[model samples]
Structure formats: C-alpha cells, structure tokens
Target: MAIRLDDITTDITLEIDEDVISIADFQKATDSFLGLVKELSRAVSGNADAASWQVKVYKGSVGVGVSPLSSGLDSLRIRNVMVSGLRALADGIRPGEFTDKAIEHSKSLASLFRKSNVDPNVRIWSQREESVRVGRSVAAGAEKLLAAVYEEDGSVDGILEKVDGHGKLQLVIYDVLNNHAVKCEFANEQLPQALASFQQRVEVVGRVRYRRDGMPVSIRATRIINYPSKPDIPTLTQMRALLSGSAST
Candidate 1:
C-alpha cells in the first residue's frame, strides 16, 4: 500500500525475527497483522466494508503504516484503539476495558511470539507511542481476564420473550437497543416478576456482558421494570391534548 507522510494516517512498527524477512514469514506476518487491524477497524467503526485501509511498509524492522481507505472512518482513531488494546493486553486489560472480541483479535496478532524462528517476545509500536511486547508473560496476564469473562454493572432494555423453566431457569430477552437476544439470569425470588413481565417490553437492570463490537450477550437481572406496550401507551394526539389541557390550567 502507498501512503504519504502528510496523510491522515499513523505509522506503527512491527519488529520481527529479522530486519530482512523471508517472503514466507512476510506473507504470514502481513496477513495476520493487516487482518487484525481490519477486524479492529470494523469493530471501531461498526462497518465491515469500511474497514478498508491503506498500509505502507518501511525498511528495517518490518515497519507498517495505517492509513484511511477513503471509507470515511477515522484511521487515527483506529490506530490509537489498536495501540490501546495491545498495551492494555500487556498490562492485563480490565473486563470492561475491551470486549472479548477485541481481546481475541489481539491474541491472534500476539500469537506471532509462538511462531518458529520468531522471538520469544513480539514488539509493536506506533510513531507516537512506546513499544509494547507480547509473549508468555503477556499471555499469562491476558488469560486471567479471558478465563473469567468480564462482568460489569449495567442494564439492558428489551422484550422478555423466551423463558426456560427446565434447566438453570434462564430467560432470553430481545434487546431493544442493539436488536439482539440478551440472555438473562434472575434470582428465584424474581420469578414472579419475570413471569409477570413476560412477552412485554421491559428494562432489565443489572450486570450486562457486551461484545467488543457493542452487542450485548447477557445480563443478570437485579430488577425488571416493565414498560407500557404500544396499545397501552398514549398516542400523539392524546399526549398533545393532555399537554394542552395542562397548559390551559
């Protein structure tokens, strides 16, 4: 890929086993690195096609450049997010710091350390940031978070449509915000509440687990607040008339 210095792009360096790399290694590294970046690009922008990028390679240390692909996505933001993810991974990113998708993607690129003839540690850095090294130590730190899925206090508003009474007593709520199913776990005491709100639009307040791409996967319900269904909700004319009466008073 051809890019200029003045372009709205960021240059990052990937130090490999050798300054002069073999074609096989180059292809392997290039495919892995670029594919990781594009995956992240899509994650950041939520546009798979817009993940396109213009990359440049520099001599010495297998330097790589990240530039916009005219897809209107912010390349600099993409580059910074990548750096943040790598650095966070090396330092052991918190559960809410990045989605599992991002971590898995990072793990893919970091797997370079496992390659033959590759150094025990793989180093990468952008022109404006310090180099981050990934290897066994980083992996050790990463596995801790990956093993225990990050759970955080959050809420989701959705329609409670599916309920499983046989097994663990799980409920599947169709998330209104992201248009996806969010598995919900509720206390036995909340069974009545869940049943009453079944097949209705409700807000599930509790812990939400979200994918890195902003899709919610599950939630542990502390409370379920049901919203009035469309038929029960006042129409525009009724709302306007009520407001008009209040104003007249």
Candidate 2:
C-alpha cells in the first residue's frame, strides 16, 4: 500500500500474524518515514531565512492483510520516534538578529506546511546576523551609508599616516578610473608597517564605512599588502585638495 502526504508519497506495507511482526517489514516502514523527513528538510533549507522547521505526524498506519493497524503498535513505533526527532531539530535553532525580509520569507515557507494532514512549520531562530567584530561586504553604487562593510578583491594604493595626537591610522587612496579619492582607517597593529611604507603604494583589504552623501568615509583594514614599486598615485593631501577644489568650483 502507499501513503500520500502532500507531495510526498511512499509505498509501505505491514505484515502481521498470530506471532511476532517480521523484521523486514519494520525496516521498510522506518526507511520510508525517514525519507519523508529528509524531503521536508531539503525543501526548507533552500530558503535563506529559514532558522528552523519541523515535520509532525498526526496519524499513520500500516496495511496488515486486508486491514490497517495504528502506528502505536510496537512494530510501528518508528513513526512516533521520527516525529519526536523532527521536533527536537526544530527546537534546537536559536533565534538571533536577522534582516526583516529574511525573517518574513522564512515565515512564508513555514505557512505552506499547515495545509496538509501533517503540520510542518518553520520557526524564526534568531535575529542576530553577524558579530560586531566581523565585517560584511556591500554592493557598489549604493546611496545609503554602509558601516563595517568590505568589498571583495578591492585593492587601494595610497599614502599611510597616523594622526599625531589621536593615535588613529589613516590611508588615502585615489581611484584613477573614477577620478576620485577615498580614505580608510587601520588597526593599531597595522600602524607600524603602514608608517614604514609611508608615501608608498600599498593594497588594503577591509570593511568600509561610507558617508550619507554616497562617499566612502573610511575603511577598517583587516589585511595590508605593501607594494615596493610606487604606482602613479597621488598623495593623500593632494587628493584631498583636488577634491576640495573640485567641490568649490
């Protein structure tokens, strides 16, 4: 016989006599139940917002001769076990900070499972996305100011300097292609090397902070690569003056 639940259908059979249930029949039932759970997990995992989801079995039975026996029978005990396992998996997820859109999408996917005889639902696990110390990457050409964001494979050449009294490190890079200038910040550990390579071309890899006006304000560098050969790049002061002059005009 076959059991159909929503889009999942599996063939299952039960054999019973005046004696004990056959081991082969028990194995077949367990395998089918597990297969259904696997399918549900795959469908939910594809959604980026999914924190946790569950599969519930309300009623299940197996065909015995011309009749059916309830899943509670010793031979059919696997059904209850599988449902318990699914619940444990769903409850394990911890809800942290997440984007509003991501959370909404996750809820929507969970709602779909409510229409079936078995109720499978997804729960929002957490609102937290990433730690404060870590940085994330943002897309280019965004108008809104982005903080602690990095650009993949983004390289900058510039002069490095430390503020005399503030103990802050700064790097000014000029984008020749766009005819613009950018500035970034460095960690205290990176200050010594940047000072040694002062006024030299260097590559910076890190997250950036942008101004509300769509201009890059600064970068928090995670890695710094020095280039011995000076590229045809302008100094930080020169770029600043040039930008200032352009703004005034």
Candidate 3:
C-alpha cells in the first residue's frame, strides 16, 4: 500500500512565472524549497536502518496518515517525509537548472509579447490623469529639500566608492534618509561632493562610520553589483558549494 505524503504535491507544480516577480526572487524562493527537500532526503537516506523510514510506503495513498513506526515521527518526521517526495521528484534539480529554465521562459515570453505588439500605453495613463494639486506640491517641496543637498554636495560619488555593491548601496541610501541626513547631525552624512556622482549612476545610501576622534562619521555609499540576468543550476550549485566550503575549486 502506498502513502500519500502530502495533498500539496499532487497537481501542485511549484507555480513560478515571470510577471509576478523578478527571476532572482523566483529562483531564491524555489531554491529554498528545494534545499529543504534535499536536506530531508539526505536525512531519510542516512536513517535507512531505522525501520519506519520507508520511502515507497510514503508514496502510496493507504499509508498516508499512518504515522511512521519510528519513535520520533512527528512534525520533523512528517516534514522529512514530504521533503523526500519533493527530492525524489526533483532528482537533484539544482539552482542552476532552475535559472536556466527561467531564462528560457523569459526569452520565450519576451518574444511572444513583442509579436503581440501589446500597447504599453497604460503606463502613461497615470502621467496624463494624475492630480498634482496636493501630491505634486508635496513632491515639489521634497524636491526642493533634496535640491539643497544635491547642490551643496555637487555629487555623492566619494561616499559611494567605499561600499561594495548594489545591496550595500541601497542600504546606505535608506540609512541616510532614515537617520535624517538633512539635519547633518551625522558626520558621515557630511561627505565630500564626489560621492554625489553615484546618485545618478546608482542609489546612494548614507551610513555612519567612526573617526579617530571617537566621533561618528557619516559616509554615503552604494553597492557595486554585477547581477546576472538569469542564474542556472550549475551556477547555483557552484555558489552553494562555495558557500558550504564543499567546492572542489
């Protein structure tokens, strides 16, 4: 008799699509699920001698809710069982494989969209119909506030150079505004004009650093990242290996 481990797995393909989110976000979500499944499968294999751990029994419907004969079969046990099913289906589908499929899918979608000649005029609807009396005035005020900072600093490049990549860049920008850079209370926020160059090139974040005087210095920086359009199974596997210290290279 076969056991049905989960009601979710049947007719439940991990619903992934290009429109809902970016390729990276989709892959991260999928890989997280896959990694957990892989771990469960590993545990199941490692516990082969444990009589209750039967992969085939879990696959059939009759044994579905029949708790594993093992002593400790509970939440973790059930998780492991479900993960085993996912792992078996995946058959070692790695991050790189998912990324490759995503890329191919995106290309196909883009081609279809182009062929359809879908008018993207809806994007401009807001521009034409927007009521700017209140919101626009507020925006203008904010622009004026930012104008002083931009003009005084010239460019935000000096601060941006210290940061490594895009993530850091975004973080820094948030840090600056969140910490009230307009007040200039933070020394790091008072960076030289060069850092402002990155304002146009990338997002600038203001962060605080300490000077030799035991005073906090505000620094504006952004992350420099070379993001790939799509990541495939091999790339993810290599990344995982590197992260896990198991990579041969």
Question: Could you tell me every candidate's TM-score relative to the true structure?
Answer: 0.47, 0.27, 0.18
Candidates 1 and 3: which is better by TM-score?
1
* lDDT agreement with native, every candidate: 0.65, 0.37, 0.29
- What candidate 3 gets wrong by more than 4 Å, as runs, is 1-19, 47-249
**Full candidate order by lDDT, most accurate first:** 1, 2, 3
Worst 10 residues of 2 by lDDT: 130-139
Instruction: List, residue by residue over 1-249, the lDDT tens digit for candidate 2.
Output: 222234222212221111222455344333433343233332333223122223322224332211113222222222232233223323432123212222222223323322245332111111121111100111111112223343433445454543332656666665544323466677788778767776655677777654444445566678889766645566787689888885344
lDDT of 3 by residue, 3-112 (tens): 11233222112222123344554354344333433333334434342234322222222211222344543435434344233232223222221222222222222222
After superposition, the stretches of candidate 2 with alpha carbons farther than 4 Å from their true spots are 1-155, 159-167, 176-179, 210-215, 230-249
Q: TM-score for model 3?
A: 0.18
Decoy 1 TM-score against native: 0.47
On lDDT, the candidate that comes out on top is 1
Order the numbered candidates by TM-score, best leading.
1, 2, 3
- What is candidate 1's lDDT per residue for 1-249, written digit by digit as tens? 322233323555555544345576567567657776666666667665555666776643455665666666766666677666777777766434344545655665565535555444456565555556655555554565555255788888878898888877788888565446678998899888888888889888898886544556788888888898789887788789888885343
